[model samples]
Target chain A: MNKGLLIVLSGPSGVGKGTVCSVLRSKMPNLTYSVSATTRPPRQGEVDGVNYFFKTREQFQEMIARDALLEHAEYVDNYYGTPRDFVDRTLASGKDIILEIEVQGALKVKEKFPQGVFIFLMPPSLDELKQRITGRGTEEQHVIDHRMSVAAEEISLIRYYDYAVVNDEIDAACKRIESIIIAEHCRKDRFMSELADMLPASEKV
Target chain B: MNKGLLIVLSGPSGVGKGTVCSVLRSKMPNLTYSVSATTRPPRQGEVDGVNYFFKTREQFQEMIARDALLEHAEYVDNYYGTPRDFVDRTLASGKDIILEIEVQGALKVKEKFPQGVFIFLMPPSLDELKQRITGRGTEEQHVIDHRMSVAAEEISLIRYYDYAVVNDEIDAACKRIESIIIAEHCRKDRFMSELADMLPASEKV
Candidate 1:
């Protein structure tokens, strides 16, 4: 059986990356969303392994020391990371894995696994992103400003990604992301290796 | 407006490339199928521009001399070539362009236009290709053998292509090609420039 592809997605905070991932997961059943292990306490209605793999700070540091995490980050006094084992197992079982990470983590993963497909999501515009952030009404003005500043740094790194999808419209962005996945699977290297075993000796010429 | 992409398609004979192209065209309305200029006589029901841009030997040679064609070939006492003007105009107008050419011509286009997306369509397996070739019932046994040999040589060059779609099922192959085209449009370079313009200054922080 052909192994599944590893996809790494990164973007600014309010680029609708989560929505794209959710829509894609709904459309594709064989996709496995890589859950990160976090050292932070679970929020209301959150479950272990479902929402996140809640790990102690010591455990998180241990995983980092052992190089067991594909990528990890410490944000807002909480440590979070993607477990390498789960992703590897999912891919080994022919299930595509998606890692929604930040630019730093994505760059690290790219360095470790050069073959992984990296996708960067972009908001329709900075103005639109500000609107979305303000519309959410969840963050204070100062926090929104901080996010906006961070977005500029992230946008500058867009050139490093293998592909980019602009989240101007949810459905269109989701479809475009899905198409990218399909196109990557149709890559020549992947197809030739898969076709090798299917060719008959007589037909090999 | 940003321009659409130019995709160059090539495959071994009897690989169901024509059928796949036809199906893909039906599904993608914005796709412009490039018409080649040829010195060959038009068959019954063939129209100029639609079937081919039939040209006199002198005209075809003049085009070759002027470098008017993207790629050209001489076969069966006739000259055939893809006109560059129409393809360029179509892509510039934000419509995708498709060029159905042989492997040699495909490589030439790739060398000339490095940004052109190259796709190679292959049969699911050599045995399956033989079955399809025999299924056509128009070729002699010797001709089939000749095609099989050529196919082997063509398969060896698959490494050069950006993508490959196995023509196991006509609809599936077409969908895959269509998806690749759509996905290519969402490339980060194209989106970043456009998105940068739409961003508001306030949101840049």
Candidate 2:
């Protein structure tokens, strides 16, 4: 079986990446959402190995030292990371896996998994981004302003991404992501090996 | 308006590129087939501008000398070429254009239009290719052998293409092409400028 694609979706904090990813999961049943490992305590209703692989500080640090995490970043004094072996096994099983991550973590992941389809989920407009952040109404004005600035910086790094989908509408964004997956499968570099077998031995290049 | 894509489809003669392209045109109404200029006499029911921009020998020679053809080739004592102005005008007008050409002509077109999406259509297998060509029953043994050798050589050149589509079924090939187009639109380089406008002036890169 052909190895499945590793789709990495990332964007600024308040760009609706989560909502788009959640909707995309239901549409693509074959897709497996990668469960991240974190040192942060699980919230109520969050399950270990399902929502996250909750780890102690020492365990997280050991994983980092052992180079077992694909990428790791500290947030609010808590460590979060992807397990390198989990992603490898999923892909080796020919199951498509998706990682919805922060822009920094996505870039970090790319360092090791350069083959992953790195997609930047872009906001429709700055005004829209600001409104989305404000609409959350969970944070103070200072927190919102900080996020907006971080979003702006993260968006400027889109040049490093393979594809950019404007999150103007969640469904539309999901559809475009689906098309990208289909198109990536058609890319010559990825599909060339299959065609190589078709070429007659004498004519093979 | 975003500049439309220049899609170039080519394959061995018996690989069903024409049939797939025709079906694709019906599905994608905005896609315009680039009408070629030819020195071959208009066949019965063939229109001048719609079917081909029919040209005389002297006119074809003048066009070649003037570099007015995007790509040209001589076949069966007849000259067939793509008009540079026509393709450029159509693309400038923001209409996606498709070109169905031979492998050699497609490569020539790429030398000038490297931005074009080059797709190499493939037969499912050598047996399938032989059957398709033999089914026509219009050639002698020598002609059939010559065509098969040529097809084998053309298949090897797939390394130069951006996508290698197996024309195992016409509709499947068309759908893959549609996905490629959608994915191309999402490519970071093509869509980045649009995102630039959304960035705050201070954050523009």
Candidate 3:
């Protein structure tokens, strides 16, 4: 079986990455979503390995020491990270996995897995990003302003990505990402064996 | 408007490259099929600049001297090559162009345009290739054998390509090629200015 691809998706806040991912999951049922490991306690109805690989701080630190995480960060006195083993096993089993991370973490993951297809999601415009943040209606004006500024910074990092998908319409964005995944599968590097098989068996290519 | 991609499609003999190109043209009306310049006299009904850019031996040699052809070779006392001017103008006008060439010529074009998406069309299997070649009913056994050996040699050069698409079914192969073109547009290299635009004007990214 062919090995699966590791897709790293990152975007500025309020760029609709989550919504696009949800639609993508519905479209492709076999796609594996990376569940992060965190030291924070799970809320109600969350399950271990399903919601996250909930770990103790000591355990999380041990994992960090062992270099078992693709990327990790400390937020609110708790540790959260992507475990490397699950990703490796899923890909080896021919199941594509997506990692939805922040820009810094995504860049860090790229340093470790340069083969991963890094994609940056973009809002239709800066105005749209502000509207989406305002549409949430939960954050204060100051918080919204802060988010817009941070989003601008994140957009600057898009050059580091392999592709930038504009999420103007949910279906169209999903289709573009889907096409990217299919195209990556057709990459020449992935078909070396198939090419070799086409050679004469006696030639010993 | 976004600049168009230069797509180079190559395959071994009897791999259905011509058939796929025909179907692809119908599906993608905006795509431009590159016209080649040749020193050979045109056959009856072949139109200049439509079928091929018919030129005299002196004219073709002059074009070569001026570095006007993307790639050229003398075949059976007739010069055949892809003209660079038409391709450049079409791409500059935001129209994607497809060049259907042999393996050696495809590699030669790669040297001139490294950004071009090089795709290798492949038969589902060697058995399928033989069946297709024999189905033509025009070539003799020795000719078919020679074609198969040449195909094996061409397949060995697939590593030089950017992508390999299996032509199991014409429609599916065309769809894969279409997806590849769409995905290439999303490449970061092609969207640098768009990425810069996504930043806030005050940010000076």
Candidate 4:
């Protein structure tokens, strides 16, 4: 089996990326979601390796020193990062992995794993995104307005991504992501070795 | 409408490219097949621009001199080439065009239109390819042997293609090609304009 693709998916908060990923996981059983390493203590019912690899602050610092983290950031006094070893192991086993990150984190991963497929999930429109955010009924108008501005900044980074998948409908978005992964496998660079094996020894024409 | 993709599909003879394309055309009604202009007179029932754009030798040479042909070659004393204007017009109309050509011709098109998606169709195996060629009952053993050697040479050029689609099954091959085209549409370069338009104007956070 060929090595799995490292896919980095990023979008604004209200773009429905989480829902699309959940649907995609259901559709693609072989897909592995990369569990992050974090300094924060896990909540109840969260399993190690399944949810996040629980790491102490000291251990997380050591991982950074060793270049073991693909990309990491400190959020609310807690360290959160993707473990390079785990991602390499999972990909070497021929299972595709998806990393859901914010725009800055996604760009960081791009620097380390340039071959990884970077996808930007977009909402159908700004109006739709506003509605989705408003439908949550948890944030104040000021917060919603701040989010819209941040989303615009993130959308501007779409040029850095290899693909832009609009999360207009859950099923369609999942299907398109699946198709992108499948099509990526057909790339000539990935299949070169197999093609070489199929070629016969030189013979007179 | 989104701009159309220029797709160049090439494979060795007897790889069932024609059959796959026929099935693909039936499945994808929006796809346009590029008809070539040739100095050779059309056979009975062949209509201009439908079967082939029949052109006099002088007319064909004039087109070449005017740089109106995307790619051209002299074969068996007849000049055959793809018209640049036709392809540009079809793509401008937002209809994807498929150019089914030999490996050499496909590579020529690539030089002119680097943006075109190049796909190399392959058989399941060399043995299968030979079997298919012999099944036609139109060539001697020597000719079949020569064709097989040439196929090997052609397969070596797969590195130049964006994707290598194995035609083990026609339906599967068509689906894979369709997926590639769809995925190509999501490419950041193609969606940049739409994304910029989607970005909201300055608003207070």
Question: Number of the top candidate by lDDT?
Answer: 3
Off by over 4 Å in 3: A201-205, B39-46, B200-205
lDDT of 1 by residue, B1-205 (tens): 8887889888988887787788877788778899999999999999999989999999999998998998889999999999988888898898889998888889888877878889998878788888988899999999999988878778777778999887778988888898898888877766656755655554331
The true-versus-predicted C-alpha distance at residue A56 of model 3, in Å, is 3.7
Model 3: docking quality category:
medium
Every model's TM-score: 0.92, 0.94, 0.91, 0.91
Candidate 1 residue runs with Cα over 4 Å from true position: A43-45, A138-140, A195-205, B190-192, B195-205
Clashes per candidate (backbone, < 3 Å): 2, 0, 0, 0
The models' CA-based lDDT, in order, is 0.85, 0.90, 0.92, 0.90
Root-mean-square deviation (CA) per prediction: 2.9, 1.8, 2.5, 3.0
Q: In model 1 chain B, where is the ten-residue run with the lowest total lDDT?
A: B196-205
lDDT of 4 by residue, A76-162 (tens): 999999999988998999889999998999999999999999999999999999999999999999999998888888888887899
The sequence of per-residue lDDT tens digits that candidate 2 reaches over residues A1-205 is: 5788999999998898889989998999899899999999999999999999999999999999999998999989999999988899999998889999999899999999899999999888888989988997898999988988888988988988999998888888998998888888878888767767877789877
Every model: iRMSD: 4.5, 1.1, 2.1, 4.9
DockQ of 3: 0.57
User: At residue A138, what lDDT does model 3 achieve?
Assistant: 99
Q: Write the per-residue lDDT of candidate 2 for residues B1-205, one digit (tens) a residue.
A: 7898899999999999889988998999889899999999999999999999999999999999999998999989999999989898888998889999999999999999999999888898978999999999888889989999999999888888998777888888898888888888889999877877878887886
lDDT of 4: 0.90
**Native interface contacts kept by each candidate, as a fraction:** 0.63, 0.83, 0.70, 0.61
